[model samples]
Target: MRRTSSISLTCLVLASATLGPALTAQSAAVTPDMVQTGSDIPAKWEEPHPGYDYEKREVMIPMRDGVKLHTVVIVPKGAKGLPILLERTPYNASGFSTDRPHMRDAVWSAQRDWADDGYIIVTQDIRGKYGSEGDYVMTRPPIGPLNPTKTDDTTDAWDTIDWLVKNIPESNGRVGMIGSSYDGWTVTMALLGPHPALKVAAPESPMIDGWMGDDWFHYGAFRQVNLDYFTEQSSQRAAGSQVPRPGSDDYQDFLDAVSAGHWAEANGFKQLPWWNRLSAHPAYDAFWQLQALDKLVVQKPASIPTVWLQGLWDQEDMYGAVHTWEALKAAGHASNNHLVMGPWYHSQVNRSAETLGPLKWKGDTAADFRRTILIPFFNTYLKDRKAAESLPAALIYNATENHWDKFADWPGVDEKHLTPMYLQSEFGLALNKPQAGEDSYLSDPAKPVPYLAPPVEADGGKRWQTWLVQDQRPVATRTDVLSYQTPVLDRAVSLEGAPFADLFVKTTGTDADFVVKIIDVYPPNDAEQPEMGGYQLPISLDIFRGRYRKSFPNPEAIPAGAVEEYRFRLPTVNYVFKPGHRIMVQIQSSLFPLYDRNPQTYVDNIFFAKPEDFRSATMTVEHNPQAASSVLLPIVSGK
Candidate 1:
């Protein structure tokens, strides 16, 4: 019998060479041979390659409600039963074939690696999508221990894995789950059920939360960019249609123009049925909770060896990954988990950038991640293969130095360098708290500064005309963005974890969004490089939106022109602010499309709001010793 063989391995290789390319995991390539044409495939199949033959067949596994879900099983040929590797995605299961053009182009990530490793890989489209029978719900259902009414994605996953083990052939029984993005979420869902066969999971860039907290929502704000873009793309895919091919250049230019002012432009938003359905049930209502991954995990947590892959600059899903990591740790699941964070964005890992900022890494970090780290992790945990545990439990790529840091935990051991860096106007950012001084700014929501970290066009073309970090220096210069910094550190100040920026403030309107950003100011330099070197470290940096200052649970309209105080937590980081470099934080009212424009009206739910509901609001910042306005840096002491 013949299975899909690599184009290169075929006797008529030169003719079929067009079908294969030199990818990192070339040996793990998915080339199918002996394409079977029948309604149902037999239990066993033979292959020309004695060492490896695979049987592919469709099977309907029963769910909790007796709903049979369609699944595809890819069993390794000739080998004894091995641990099962599971993947559940909304994407079609039939497309899981390794030899497909899309998979070869790096578009499909999970299937290739595991299939190549002699593992029995199974891919299933979640119930209600594609081949599965059930009404497809976009996000997971929410029912956690803390809040017990949720019936979510985890429940569905539990049903699937429970069925797979009992029926699949050549089953050594152990199971491991791996996938990125939505597939990542599926893995997390599976972990929640804690199957005896489940040994490990790797969830990369998962959508962990749904409310105005993560992914689907922001700080009391919906994610306009993602909601509009994802709904359109997902709905199309769900309908068995492809993302419209890149149209004419003129049409592409139109998309670019529409994306320019996405926050303000009503015409740019995609109007998909799913988006409408999602908007109707806004707030952290039970509807959204059913879809919240963190809440579900906290209630029905997964007890398995887990690895989380997070991208610091991921335009989408960064909050979900980071917040999920923190939540799991807080729930006391820290010891069994590890994190691998890079300076890449959503799809940036495909090519893998060596230099994120001014720093350069040692190798093809993505490939290194796959070959050295990921493979070993699954091999050891799932296959019970003995291997060195020397690899750091956590691997983080520092953007500033562009190097990898290995540690036993997400937040490395404390190096105890807690120093209060005050925001002084004269010296920019003072290392010590200021004696007595005040900085003032007016935050106009209508004229809020655009988020400049990454530029992505939901409709299609890139927004080159708008702000990227390069164009953001001007915005950072605005009075609206209250900038405070500590003078260049005399010695390197290493920050290993989350930092808090407690602010004192007064607002002239009912509400205001306080956006805090921490920047690692680079050393002064004068070099004429193609990428622009005059501004050594003029990056817009990290930003966190602040609207529901008091609580995400209940947000009220601030009395017009009233004074209020809030604490903003900057995203976690581990970096050494080198000598002569400054640590800076900029506070503003809005992060634009990165977060939906706050309506300024202290409304209970804002997801289903309209353009008319948005109101202009004013913001102010106060600095006083009584306010004790300061940033608490989680500096690692005895490094």
Candidate 2:
């Protein structure tokens, strides 16, 4: 228990609340008429939940194309046949409102503490987004046998769980699916086809793999700040396209004037056409795997009971939770699965409990992940109960000794493949050790690095995991950024699993863009702790897009410096490098606008580039050991 004291012991249960004795018997007196409810109310109504007794309604289910979606259940007051926690979303699932009281301090909501802890929550709105209907197919729509107007997303979540287990009343037929990030891709697209009252799922940080290359696109590039600010703060009225809401202080000062790029009189594309149809798809073809969504985690749909939440400093859907946990462990379903990964980010359980970024954990890692790993993982498999069956199918948290360990698997058989730490002094990085003479850089797809992350002003803050560690500390203080260091740790260095980067290079130009960064410096502490000024200390980072390395399905054109060998996997970390921390690696090309401008001229389609193929490309970094450029940590040891 020492990842810096597991963020001060999960910040004292991050605002402890099982709904605190039902919000200490109500009345903290908030009234917009206590959130309005009449239409002759009754459908087993009761509402007024600050503490408990909630039971609200609004059902209308259908959808197999017969369309009728709109759901919002709730339930708490003496609920008996429980077990139905679900949460499908295109966002507004009517704020999961039961007269809005149970926010006993939320950072990730789905009715805090599952309606006074008895379950039966429900909250839907999938088909065509708001109010639900028909046309809103973004993520996984094309089912098996490869495309033929397939109709999927698990057949609209198996006709909305067959009309909520035949009209919901105290439904204990059992069902469980949690949310976070497109409600974690609608519980990984409603745990695929298997709906016999589902069983359990916990998708957190998912967009499963839709906006391509993992959330709004990255490796195939074009995630220009979360698909241009989530295509202008979503609400295309599910694509029929409607507008008039824009004023969040005039869209935060037009994203502070396009986060300073001056994108032609910024209206960020007059309310984002899903970021202009994702710059009309760039590479990893089949139109981003027909809008990915990890093809619904390799269709394991059913034997449920899973729990996956990732955030190694998340920075938005960390490769859709590491490629949907490696396609649900290659479809064998890893004995009912459970994975966690911490160092939080991307709404790290509602940021700001003093600090998460400049590393200050000692408490509330999102209320101890909703009471020690989501209420004992829904009281051990949707209330059949055993309360975490001897726990630890996996429970990581480990950021720089931020604690929470236990692991039976999920990258923990005590990995230790460690070796490549090359990049000798142009400034940093050493392992096979040598201080040579080689450091070239001139990337420029028309002057990049404006993907934006300087103290976050917004316009989807150019997504290199939202300027992670301020985009590798300005590409390690650029000279065309090439710092790589590793000579500061004598004893402690625990980096529990998954991170690869191998490159042997040469590129003067025919096509070039190699960016790799993995840092976590922190040793020079204090500058201000007024509640930790400028949160970002244990320093975690991630970025990779070297022309999708070798085949994310064909892309080549690097003839200039000519001498290539690229491989990148980086992004999946559990970090722990104490004893005065320092483990950096930064190599650059450009993370600009969170990746888009390649144009080194392989152009079959880089979204029709022609700003004179955005010139500038001299980039190399081979610091020879027989050209073995490095970074491949897994590292864990002994029992």
Name the lDDT value of residue 379 in candidate 1: 86
For model 1, the local distance difference test gives 0.62
Provide the overall lDDT of each model, using Cα atoms, as 2-decimal numbers. Answer: 0.62, 0.62
Worst 10 residues of 1 by lDDT: 99-108
Task: Give the TM-scores of the predictions, in the order they appear.
Answer: 0.77, 0.35
**1-639, model 2: which lDDT tens digit per residue?**
469788876776775655576677676758696685666656774545556455567776876557788888766666678787777877677855624444333213535666556777777887777787776645545565444554565677777777777777677777777778877777776676667777778888877665444566556655544434444335465433322234433223323333322342143453444445545555576656754655645744456777777776666677776666656666767677677766667646534333454456778677667766677777776776776545566777775566777778766322356656667745566665554446677766655554354333344423334345442454456566676666666667666666677767787666666667776665555354553322223233345445666676576666666668777666766667665556777777666655555656556555555556557777777666566577767766541
Q: In lDDT terms, how accurate is model 2? A: 0.62
Model 1 / residue 187 / CA error / Å: 1.4
CA error at residue 588 for candidate 2, angstroms:
14
Clashes of 2: 34
- Deviation of model 1 at 151, angstroms: 7.3
| lDDT digits (tens) for residues 469-566 of candidate 1 | 34335566887777666665778777776676677776665656666666665546525343432242433233433446666655566777666777
